[model samples]
Target: MTAPALPRHRSAALAESLVLVGRSVRLSRRDVETLVMAIALPLLMMALFVYVFGGAIETGGAYLTYVVPGIVLLCVGFGAAATAPAVADDMGRGMVDRLRSMPVAAAALVTGHVVASVARNALATGVVVAAAIAMGFRPDAEPLEWAAALGLLLLYVLALSALAAGLGALASSVQSASALTFFMLFLPYLSSAFVPTGTMPAVLRAVAEHQPITPVIETVRGLLTGAPIGSAGWAAVLWCVGLLVVSSGFAAWAYRRRTRR
Candidate 1:
C-alpha cells in the first residue's frame, strides 16, 4: 500500500507548532512540582555537592569550578526528561487524538514538545548557573566561550527531548513514561560529572568514559574553564548531532504509529 501523503504546508505547521509550544510553556510555568525539580532541585544538589562533598574531593581548591559544568548538564538532563511525562499526559488525555483530527501537521506536536523543553532547560540552566555563581563558582571564559557552551546545551536538550518524546509516545501510561525517565536522572552519576571517571573501578570507568554524557560534560568544563577540550569536544558535537537525527526519526515514527487511524 502507498504511504499516507505527508503534510505539505510547512508554514501552517510551523505556526501551529509555535502556538502549541507557547501553551506547553505556560503549563510548565504553572506546574509547581516541575518548577521545583527543574530549577530548585539542581541548585540544591549543586550546593550539597559543593559544600558537603567539596572538602573530600581533591580539585585543587576549584571544586565549584569543576562541578558547576556537570550541574548545568544535570539541570538540562532533568528538564529534558520532564518532557516525557508531559507528552504522555497529553496522549493519555486524548490531546494527541484531538490534534491529529485537525488539519495541522502531525509532526507539529513533537516539535512543540521539543521547543517547550528547550525553553525549560534553558531557564533551568540559567538558574543553576546563577546559584553556582552565588555559591562561589567563577569562570574566566570569554563571551564566545559562553556562547559555544550555551549552543552545545541547546543541541543536547533538543536531542534528549526528542528521545524522551519518543519514549513518552511509546509508553502506555504517564507513570511508565515517568519511570523510564528515571534512568536519565541516574545517568550523570555514572559519567564524569561528579568525579573523574579514572577514579571509578575498571568496568564502571570504561562505561562511564564511553557514555554520551561524559564527553558533553568534558566539553562544557573545557569551555567554562578555558581548558583544552581536544577530541572530547568533537565527540560531544557528534553525539548531539547523531542523537538528534536518530531521536527525531524515532519520535516521528512513534507518533505516527501511536496516532495511526
Candidate 2:
C-alpha cells in the first residue's frame, strides 16, 4: 500500500505566526503590570519630567518640546526590554519545547513575539504622545516630518526588540533574562535623552556622541523641532539597520542552540 505524504508545515508558517501573536497579545493584555508598564509608566514619566524638571533643565527653548521626543524613545526602549521576560517565560515553562515538537515553523515563535511587541510599542508611543500634547508639549514639525519621526522610532524599536529577544534566548532563566536586558533601560541616560550630551563631561560627551542612542534622539529632536538634522538622520538609520541585522542573526542562532539542548 502506498502512503500519502504529510503536508508541509512551512506552508502555514504565516498563519501560525499570527495565531501566536494573538496569544502573546492576549497574555500581555491580561497582565496588569504589562498594562501599567506599556501605558501608565510612560505617562507618569512624561508628566514628572515635563512638570518637575522642565523648569530646571534649560534647553534654550521650551523644555517640554526638548524632552517629549526623548520620552517617546525611552518608552520604545522599555517596550523592547519587556519582551525578554516573555520569551524567557516560554522557555522556562517548556512551552517552546512543545512548540518545537509541533509542525510549526521554527521562525514563527520569534516572529510572533516580535509582531506583538511592535503593536504593543505603537500603543505605548501613542499614549505617551497624547499625554505630552495634553500637557502643552508641541512640536513644530510638519506632517511629513512627523511621519519621518515615526518611521525612525519604528526602526529603533524593531532593532531593540530583536536585541532583547537575543538576550532572552541566551539567558538560562527569566531572572537572568531580566537582569541581562537591564542595559537597555539605562542606556538612554548615557545618551541625549534627558539632557544635551554637549553639557556632559568630556569623557562622557565622547561616549554620548558616539553611542547609538544619541544619534537617534538627536534625529527625532531635530525632526520635531524643525532643527537641521545634519547627518544624524542617516546615522540613526544605519545604527538601527545594523543592530537589527546583528541581533536578529544572534537571536536565530541562540534559539536553535537552546532548542538543540
Candidate 3:
C-alpha cells in the first residue's frame, strides 16, 4: 500500500495568515465595533491627556507631539493584551486542538492574530496622526524618515504581539492572561511618555532614560522632528529584534508544549 500523506507542520505560511486574520472576528455587524474599541480608544486617550493637562505639563514642545507616539505604543500594548485572552479562549473551547489536527500551518495560529492586530493598529495610528495634524503637530522630517519611524513602531508592536502569544501559550486560564498583559500598557507611562525624563525624580529618570521605551520614544521623536537619532535609535532597533527573537522562540515552545501529546 502507498504511504499516507502527512500534514504540514504549520497551518499556513506567514503570508497566508494575513488573509486569515480578522476572519474569526467581526463575523456579524455588532462585532465590528471592536475595531473602534481597540483602535480608536487610544487616540481618544491622547486627546484627553493633551487637552486636559497640556498647559500644566511642559514637554519642551507641543504636548500632543511629545505624547502621541507614546500613546501609539500604549495602544500596541493594550492591543497585545487582547491576544492572550483570545488564545486562551480558543484553546479552552477546543478550537486550537481542532485546528492543530487539520492540515493548517502551525504558524498560522499566531500569524492570524498578529496580522489582524496590525490592521487595527494601523487604523489607530492613522486616527492619532490626523488628530495631531489637526492640532498643529507637524512632522519636521521628510516623508521617508516618517516612514522609518512608523516602521520601527510597527516592528516593536510585532515583537510585543509575539511576546503576548507566548504568554497566552503558557497561561493555564484566561484570567491570568488578561491580568498579565497590563504591564505593557503600564510601563510606557513610567517612561518618557507624558513628561521628559529630565523632569522626573533623579533615580526614576536614570532608569527611564536607560529603559527600552526611552530608546523607542526618543527614536520616534527624533525622526518625527528631524532631530538626531543618537545611540538610542540603534538601541531601539536592537532591543526590538532581541525581544522578537526571544519571545518567538518561547511562543513556539509554549505552543508545542500545549499541543504535543
Task: Estimate, for each residue in 32-126, the C-alpha lDDT of model 1 and write its tens digit.
Answer: 78877789889888989888997798865488998999888888889999899888888888677788888887888888888999998888888
Badly placed stretches (over 4 Å) of model 1 are 1-8
| Candidate 2 TM-score, true structure as reference | 0.93
lDDT of 2 by residue, 230-254 (tens): 9999999999999989988988988
By summed lDDT, which 10 consecutive residues of candidate 1 come out lowest? 2-11
What is the alpha-carbon lDDT for the whole of candidate 2? Answer: 0.85
Per-candidate clash tally: 0, 0, 7
User: TM-scores for all candidates?
Assistant: 0.94, 0.93, 0.88
Pairs clashing in candidate 2?
Answer: none
Q: Against the correct fold, how does model 3 do in TM-score?
A: 0.88
**Alpha-carbon local distance difference test for all models:** 0.88, 0.85, 0.76
Candidate 1, pairs of clashing residues: none
The digit string of per-residue lDDT tens for model 3 on 14-44 reads 5456555656343212446656677777877
Q: Using TM-score as the measure, which candidate wins?
A: 1
